[model samples]
Target chain A: MAIKVLHHGLATTVQDLGRPGYFHLGIPVGGAMDRYAMRAANLLVGNDEGAAGLEAVFIGPKLEFTEDALVAVTGADMPTKVDGVAQPGWTAFKVKAGQTLTFDFLKSGARICIAVSGGIDVPEALGSRSTYPIGALGGYKGRPLTAGDELPVGKSNLASEGRNVPEALRRRPGPSAELRVLPGLYWHRVTEESQQNFFADEWKVANEADRMGYRFKGGRKLDFVDREQPFGAGSDPSNIVDSCYPYGSIQVPGGTEPIILHRDAVSGGGYFMVGTVISADMDLIGQLQPHSPTRFVKVTMEDALAARRVRQLNLARLREALA
Target chain B: MSARYTFGGDEHLFVECSEEMSLEAFFTSLSMAKGVRESGIKGVTEICPANASLQMKFDPDVIHPNDILKEVKAIEGAAARAEPVLKTRIVEIPVFYNDPWTHETLMRFRERHQDPTGTDLDYAARINGYGAVDDFVGAHSGSPWFVSMVGFVAGLPFMYQMVERQRQIQVPKYLRPRTDTPKLTVGHGGCFGCIYSVRGAGGYQMFGITPMPIFDPTQTTSYLRDFMVFFRPGDIVKFKPIDRDAYDQAVEDVDKGRFAPPIREVSFDLREFQKDIDGCNAMLEGMLNGH
Candidate 1:
């Protein structure tokens, strides 16, 4: 009926595909950062792709299954174990009543998703169970799960253990990643030389990476075109009138670092946005570790659309392989 | 009116109605968002109408981005003719100006402030040409402000004063972003007043704290039983300054589920207000006082 928390991970929260229609109200589409992994894990456990699951960051949570259930862990290269017995990543396995689940040191990635056969049954808020700690909405009490909390589980459709996803199908960041971006309207605010340098320079994922945004450092600071500061804007060159920040939009606060907003981003702000990372690359961002080297590649609108199609086809292939 | 339409990414189309923040820009964004919604544009997962701008999140796979762009441009053209009027509510928000919570927080992050020697309220007052904090508070609470945008965090409303441009209070943000701001803390920056719905990072110049909840995700507050978010984009707010005893009493009433926010439904016409700015604001305030 429930999964009792033994040891809460560094930051484990309930997530689904997220509530999508509330951004105008400053509500982000709060969900698993690595959405592809969440869908894959749910598929392995025979649950709906968008079913609520536990998204743990860096460290894994110690959980005790109160009843027999099927579970799958996906996203990172973390070693999973039940009752101290090793289990394969991206493969559904069975855990008996009173059995404990734990994890070893993270091998490569920054996050992991554990999808149970019966999805985590947290009550829906704004049509989602995703935890948005900023607004204190959804999930287990609108924050990270803590020790001694019993998480309710939904009714299962039943799946046998040993359902495995192919190795290549499981996406993780390599030593370096090239995130494609499409420059938007605010791109003009930045100097032309700086725009070219942005693509030329390499960037490293700063420690500021989280559900809200991924800050990239180790790159040359961007220069702006000198202009009289607009009314209702800050004196800094990087400031714009407070505006909406679309998911994946790269905002350079003070022109120093580019923070690529992710799932739990604030709806609007005053920073100048240079561009937005293509949607196809956002899931890969969630798996990138701190200090991971990265590059920005500019793409046209057509190229972006093509990449999105490729991602859709990839998900389709995943569904077919699981079916 | 002019707008720049650009692709945010494969999934989102960002439309900047203006480069500067103005009531006209906000009205255009609201109208465009309404146009797109009424057009029933397919594949639009979300439409965010921000200050001076708007964004639409669409699934390119369903309706191609190019197609949506064409449709949105057509909608924008038609929206130009639409009347700029809104049926919104006016709510009286009780604020304890120079409250202890925001005062402590502002003092903690003074190094980030341009004038570190003075409190945020004092600094905000001094720069705006007020000799006393009471006169500043009177100016702030005298006029009903329009909710220009509701964002930066959940249910936090960014407001513009009802007064004309010359009388507007403008202040710079923190020299550096602060790591924290008290929840329900009333803040001002870049000619906009904002209420921090929850405790988190902020860069605004803090002035006061509100006893009433601006946003409650749990839907537990007495006034928020119907909706978790208390403010919307088109709402009007009048800040009513209160003493320490009323602030404490309001908090107690909230705990007992007896605090009902002062709200009144009213019709607002943009052109009407612009024609008689002071007169309309006085009328609006009178309506709220009667409520």
Candidate 2:
């Protein structure tokens, strides 16, 4: 054991890039919500891009180091400290043995990723160190870390510290975020007016947001087109015959709440998804806080592809810079 | 063959085979999903087949999304005339009807149910034209079920009855979803039945509880040794109702890692089953008991 948890922050857990191949088994690709931040933290600490790290939400965990090691904190704008002294985020720093690390209240963003010299030394479950609490698999015993839990750290490669990512390299969305969505298969299920309203409306993130999904409130109720209820699809106009819910898809139950499926969502369900948030914007969704004003900007397939390409290039730049 | 293909953002391709849920549509979707997997497509990462639709997630960087779409359309055209046959397995799941665990949970969520005064079973029986709950249970257990999709949660099988459409057991989900549902509780909603793999929020009408655990991450159960998630998409399931004493014995055996369920391998032909469903089903059942 290398790190002892002095205080369990709000919903802190070990995460990596997650197990992608298991989506067919109904096991979601659950990992760090903000993949970019997680990768940045790992890169700063000289760890592999997808190495396991601690994903702390809202608040940060108070941890005491049992051994001197390199560490980096990324994502969010929370203030970090080492044994009462201040520390800069997104920059690798060393903590001496017996030194305590803590955080001030969150200043901005939703989640923070803390990467140490070596990755979290948890045995891989299903070829991943991601925590999927729904299935009770992976991570530190398949659940969120709590106070008094002593975590094991992998053998450090002994890389030098103080490598900070440039300010421009840090990716965070604005306070009022505009998420581009590509409407799909079930788009025709809604009336044209309601579809326009969905794009035009300004919504606020609900308190129900978590790893499974983020629900948006304060939007006009969506209206569905009239159709003979399909056989075997429940009577609700919004219900489909249980279909796959693609990651980042927006599912509206009863034409009310619009939930954007996130990292730990179910693979398939009966609710109809209006559209999917573009892959480039999923990371942005993770950094959004509850009650944040958000807009769903509709985009075409080509637009979505172009955005994905731009983000891929940015990630490439990050890798090159760190390398 | 004219499946409606829609792009799910930059990654997923959603293919809708039919507007309504049916055994034929499920097979059609499954065939396409299987065809995509076997084709060794460069970018396809995951293929999930649902009731009457399927989704394939591909890396757009490796293969352009449109190029993958063209390949999928070609595969759909190629499998258009081929008869669907699945070499699958059939397993018996022992259940205790009206088990006290589910009964207590269902009672707590009565406000969300369709008929608040009556139990879920009685309400379902009345809506489906069954004279009593016993008759409804008989009809439910009498027919074999196909695991059309194993999802919503890990290892949770969404099943469709092998019986004709007119004989299918249908129920609406609770007016509102309950905050809690007992694990392994047999649930029915729409025309599908699902076994809750883990305890969580649910809206389906609770029918019973199974003695066997279909989902185990630890793989501690003897039946789950081959895989942590027991039920697959193509397996057929038959529910065998047992009394309280038998249910207790099965639980005890499961705790001791001695529960080896009755399972058999068999090939399912859509054409043959369509021609003589009951006859083919009887033969399939006979194979299970060595008749």
True contacts kept of each: 0.89, 0.84
Calculate candidate 1's fnat.
0.89
For each candidate, report its DockQ versus the true two-chain complex.
0.85, 0.86
Candidate 2 CAPRI level: high
Residue range B37-147, candidate 1, lDDT tens digits: 888998998888888889999998789888998999998887778888888999999999999899899889989999988898888889899999999999999999989
Cα RMSDs, all models: 1.2, 1.1
lDDT of 1 at B210: 90
Model 1 regions lying over 4 Å from their true place: none
